[model samples]
Target chain A: MVEPLRHVTPFWPAFWRGFRALMPLWLGIIPFAVAYAVTARAAGLGVGETQLMSLTVFAGASQFAAAGLFAGGASAWGIVATTFLLNARHVLYGLSLARQVPLTRPERVLAAQFLTDEAYGVTVVHGAREPGGLSFGFLLGAELSLYAVWNAATFAGALAGAVLPDPAALGVGVVFPLAFLGLLVPLLVDRKAVIVALASGLGAWGLSRVLPGGLVVLLAGVGGALLGAVLVTRRGEA
Target chain B: MSVPLVTLLMWLVTYPARLLGLSLGRLKLPPFWLAFLRFVPVSVFAALIVPDVLGSPEWPRRLVGCAVGVGLMWRTRNLALGILGGFGAYWLARLAGL
Candidate 1:
């Protein structure tokens, strides 16, 4: 087991690579964060409330889902239920990181705070490519930068909502999906992946008609995973 | 609790779950669950994106945007470029009265 803090290169190359890896994704975060703030505030949250949600929950999709329900005049319990349902996916992240990194209790606490979708994906991809300890530096850079930008965007959006003309006309809400789609596009490599993507997509659409809140997301994801795994396994047998 | 208090409360509450998972790392997690864990990001993301691409009510325009986005992302492996293609296609179709 490598010590977690062994590599200490105080140099330009590491900084440059880390910056390159993170900046594009971080740049796109501004619109999404701003949208979240505006929408959350619009949904009756004060500026402080909006910032609080982002700072703590930091789960973009769940927050948005919560805000949408809030805006629709859903009960507070309804809002909580929706957010909980949407963020149920984080449980998977907790499990994966647990096996890979034998963290102390304190480290696990920090890991949960830092493990957003982008951060986790980047961390896992780098971990696969190189030793885990060395990759922590890169992961930290990405995660910290995201933390700063996301909070900053939340603040800005809240401020803007207090002053600016309507953001809806510009389709500010759409930016969230656009940003996600950007991330999603890079990962669809193989036939199985494509099939899973399509299946999940269709499943979510069909299920959402009957299911309330974020159950559709959960159902589609589970369905896709089962389908993809079965297809991959059958292919291996052949 | 107030908003900031709620924020702090959530952070504090989730802390235990994180720590528990970490400390229990030594215990063997179920293999099938771990395997499923590997694909959660992509799978969850797809569940979110597909519905958007298909555009809730405007089917034709949304389909076009989704196609363009998926195609560009496939060819360039540039996420930004793919997003631009999809978003631009949507706007263009809207502008052309589609």
Candidate 2:
């Protein structure tokens, strides 16, 4: 019965589905990438270096941090240290997604290059819906589209330079939070998920007032996940 | 100190964390750990977003955009439309000088 459905939908179809699934996320991604480009350029990075940073570093928050530090006349080592501290959440993301999508070392290495918060969110949501687990084709499709959009937006912003106006002034900065709200709505399917999400959100916001950098998010997420696991185990035993 | 060297160092510090879990994929995690991992996607996203929604500049406009976004997603369950609605609301608020 399911055989025909499986045969009809091949690897390419899954890949395309992944691409299309990420289309909505472009709302936030476009503005953020453009902001990074404009900020990097304004911070005295040449066009080549600005583009290179987007292409290689690929982490949005860290890129913004690095650009700000550079513009402030911080030392190279200072910029690197600050950016590294801001990106430590990626380790948590990688750990969460590692088992969900099994792949060989080489493929994993390649995929790691494209693992942004947005990519991971979309991949895991899609994975949960499909019984067969996460596919490499789907991951590739989603990541590649995000990567392409980010790089292109960066280039456009860099080329436009100061003429582009501030993305924030135009209300573009709201797109990220709005887009995330959209993503979060669909994931709240049960009591446990809601508790975990709410706890994590509140914890992060509270900790951000006192702590520095990305550690707030990482610690909050870990705490929420641990709480969720215990709740699930208790429910199961009941 | 050079731009290229700095870029290389940035990549070195960042990419390792992204790749570490994949390299350790062969190790089997306990069931409790796996259950915990399942909640991570939502937790991570919530952690990323809530701060911005609560603390963004131009509080009134951002609040309106967020309300519209959540309302649209709740009513329609369409991600693109919800985002577009939020973007439109934000632009409207800005245009109104809010």
Candidate 3:
């Protein structure tokens, strides 16, 4: 093979570019991953199970929700229900990314595997400038780096699980809620979103008094989103 | 269900939803639906976070942690800062028996 300018190792620039793009976000992601593993351990997930979920699901919020629900002894169906809603937005990410970057069928499959919120967001910004930003190489790089970092963090946190003393005494009890709190605040983008959050958050608190906790989350999510949609429509054309 | 089963179930739901998105990307859904979907993350996150905060035995501590977290994250827009700051506040509060 003829060597070209700047082609020594033969790695695609876009791939490394995507990896670098995602590297910065991992600083925010590590604690969340660690918290997940610690919470999972507290929730009675074996180390194997915790690693397996991170390995498979890869979505952070829903994994935390599932761990909380598992600690609360929610049913399997409840876990599935929450996971579905939490991840339903993945479809939108795929749609948006596909619109931005024309991906082949195989590319679609692989990209979907790595199409996390962070990966999607970073790639979107790059896609605007770099032709290869949202390409498969980019996604592979960004997502794989995320995947590796997340799993490694989970493992480290799992070890911390054994090391950290009783959950309540060390104030570890707040980690789960704190983790979700960090995620929630960022999503409050506008008045409509804020209202939806308030409505749903209050709904969850109230429903927790009577309903199962898992069910409350599901109901609040659907009800709040519906309310937001109605408000949007009433205001004007979407 | 067992751990693997639950994980499999989540995967079953997630992958298909994403695949459906790619196929349906060609056809734009109604604008109202799009707006609705956009709000789903906030709604879902609030639902997940609030009940956990309100239902805790150490709610006062949890709320303090949450308030600081929300404030810092909203102000700084830095996730790590928010988490660590809130966590530090929580640990201090817990130690002081708050």
Candidate 4:
């Protein structure tokens, strides 16, 4: 028999449960984090600066873009602008999850610090499955684990820089896309989802041709969401 | 500007953007808007993966890896196995000179 939903699970178990849930995602993140470290080092960032960026900034794509631009002698303002643009998607993630994960103001700020693509993905899955509503403990656990792994991997890669062979040659580049695909395929539950996903993919690809980095993704996401909203309303009416 | 200053600027712009939505938690969104937000994850992931998959230097290997991943997830309903299946497949394909 199914047990009644508890208003709260014990903190420790919920934390560990969140940690374990994200272990699979860690597989992909491990390599990606290492690659970022290596690339940052290669791009002329000092060890201290690279580690600091990983520790503080914590956004992957923006970190990479910033490092590349820095290497190319792009102005600091340009780098900042690009990074800001790339990370704009996080607002969407934060918005989607805000109401679901109930937390005090301070707790929300703390949780927002660890919000990444992987954490948000795991949290969404957890929110949908957990009958007891959003578990702040679970979110903390997952975010902390990813955070720990990412930093550790980055430090390891920085220390091992120049010795490591090209990540692309070893197929490490594919890990991220496949990881995302792993998360995505499960969510394509209906015709509406499939259509929205396809349209978003095509829209992003087309936009990438003319748009600056990150803007393509932002625009495509908005377009896709609008399409999804329309489809949902039509389905409801039907 | 110094590296430290650059890093600080990056953090300033980036961090606040992440936190912006959280501050608006109390504002009730319309159902249509919420439904649209529900699709954001799917859209975001799709946007992330499609470009890389299509533009991969080793398309055959990446394609096979993705297939292995999806197939594993479908069968086991397990995220870890799916990641491992895809990661392992990509490496195997590279080793096989694909």
Highest lDDT among the candidates is held by which one?
4
Assign candidate 2 its CAPRI class.
medium
Residue A234 Cα positional deviation in candidate 3, in Å, after optimal superposition: 1.0
Q: In angstroms, how far off is A212's CA in candidate 3?
A: 5.1
Model 4 stretches astray by more than 4 angstroms: A1-6, B95-97
lDDT comparing candidate 3 with the true structure: 0.76
State the lDDT at A108 in candidate 3. 79
Tens-digit lDDT track for model 2 on A13-69? Answer: 767777888888987888898888888888898888988988898888888888887
**TM-score of each prediction:** 0.81, 0.91, 0.69, 0.94
Give stretches of model 3 more than 4 Å off: A1-50, A59-103, A114-146, A157-161, A176-189, A209-215, B1-10
**Each candidate's DockQ:** 0.46, 0.66, 0.52, 0.69
Give the Å shift of residue A224 in candidate 3: 2.0
> Model 1 clash pairs?
none
Candidate number of the best TM-score: 4
Worst 10 residues of 3 chain A by lDDT: A1-10
lDDT of 3 at A88: 77
For model 2, the stretches where C-alpha displacement exceeds 4 angstroms are A1-10, A129-132, B93-98
Residues A36-92 of candidate 4: C-alpha lDDT, one tens digit per residue: 888888888888898899888888888888888888899999999998899899899
RMSD list, candidates in order: 3.8, 3.6, 6.5, 3.5
Ranking by TM-score: 4, 2, 1, 3
Window of ten residues with lowest summed lDDT in model 2 chain B = B21-30
Model 4 chain A lDDT-worst window of ten:
A1-10
